[model samples]
Target: MKQRIAWITDSTAVVPDELREKYDIHVVPLDVIFEDGAYADGIQLSSSELYEKIDHSKTVPKTSQPAIGKFVELYEQLAEDYDCAIAIHLSSQLSGTYNTSKSAAAMSEFPVEFVDSQIVSYPITTLLLKGISLAEQGMDYREIAATLREEASKNENYIVIGKLSQLHKGGRLSNAQLIVGTLLQIKPIFCIRNGVVELFEKVRTEGKAFRRIMDQLDLARGIHKISQVEILHGNVMDKALELKETIKSKYQDIEVLVYPLSPVLGVHGGQGTIALTWTNEPKSS
Candidate 1:
């Protein structure tokens, strides 16, 4: 008999509602905490609402991973139907969601395979989509999990910080760096390296920063065949659309998508921030 597998991911992964419904993909939401209280990332607080709150508030919000009990409850429920589950989450270095899910899986009677995507946003979406396709092709749960773990490292992202103060508040930047960057009007470009966000370069203006990102894309194309490009923004749809158009004009063969970043991500990236994420085609052994 074919093994029944359940697909699970965190809200940080941008799985469209229709696709999630079609694949029966389950999503566990993270918490976005404001001064007053905490709200579920995509459920209790929409991205637009979160941004609106940020605009009117004096303090930036923080994010928290889902409780281990929540995952345990989910696993117990899935155990009734599915033979096993594959849980994919954002980087372990970035969030405690992966560790929380692992602990929950260990306590449950059901079998759960976890994939630490080592990245976030659209790249995680691409990995989940690929895993779904692999499962549809008759791959077992273990094979699909292993394939996703390997493919996870082949993705890359470049984020352009919109507000320097937000990074400083998140503890990603020092006060000295923030003060200097603010004085110099520097736009810092960051990338995920070894599962942690790191500064890639600093430019004087957003225009120059975008150019640098495109240049990196060009170099990446030479090294690996890119499958998809996603432009994610924090309440900046116009800029994301423009960047999408530019990428489409250059790489007509590659698929491109544009959408708002989740509220949890927006809390860190801040309003007006934009990111470019792409996945490379897997290499043959």
Candidate 2:
């Protein structure tokens, strides 16, 4: 059989409910465990469900990647139908899912192509979606994966962490720092660097943090064309909407999309955090 291509990604894609079935993309679920048993990220639990869990549990829930069986099963099934599978995964710095997928692919009968998105949330999702688009246009698997990685590496993500309390609960910050930052209403903005999450900047107030984020957008667009943009938030539709409008006005021709943050990300940034991701340069094959 001639080689056919298919795309696969993790649940962080936050794929619009409207688009999943239309595309031949697979969204593998992550794992979350609380006081009792464990459940898949979106199959058995949702973001709202995670919020409730966080409220009642004395300790924050733990998260894990999908089992190796999950990836192997998908690989085997897709191998029968397609020439090879291009599996794009979340950053190895953030989770072990990328490595897990790597291990699964080694044992699978089919040749599985895996990529470390090196970015998180919709940034990586955008890369996978774009690759899928190209694949639909008859792009080769290896070419698709390489293009996806190149484009993803040129992307940038900015997070204006709305609350320190959430990071504290998620164990990203210590009690003393969280308490101090929360007391002073300080917000920290983070950026992804070379596959690792790092501290980017800090602001004294939410207003400044948001303004700085917008400023970065302007600067990035000036340097390169902004191909894709996503605004990730918890429940702050108003803030996200405001940011969207600002983006639309400033870059009238750019494509901008917004969606809620996934539970895994929401846990660390807290309810009102706003994360913006966009391509910093044009992607060429």
Best by lDDT: 1
Model 2 C-alpha lDDT per residue in residues 1-285, reported as the tens digit of each score: 335776778886677665677777788888788879887877788877777787887777787888999988888788788878888888888888888887877888788777888977787677777887887787778888888878768878889886576678778789899888988888899998888889999889988888898889888877787766889887688999999998888888877788888877766677788898887775353
Per-prediction backbone clash count = 0, 0
Candidate 2 backbone collisions, by pair: none
Native-to-model Cα distance after best TM-score fit, residue 129 in candidate 1, in Å = 1.0
Estimate the TM-score of every prediction.
0.95, 0.93
Evaluate all candidate structures by whole-model CA lDDT and list the values in order.
Answer: 0.90, 0.81
| TM-score, model 2 to reference | 0.93
Model 2, position 39: C-alpha lDDT score = 76
Tens digits of lDDT, candidate 1, 9-125 = 999989898988899999999999999999998999998999889877777888999999999999999999999999999999999999999999899978989999999888888
Which window of ten consecutive residues has the lowest lDDT sum in model 1? Answer: 276-285
Span of ten consecutive residues with least summed lDDT in model 2: 1-10
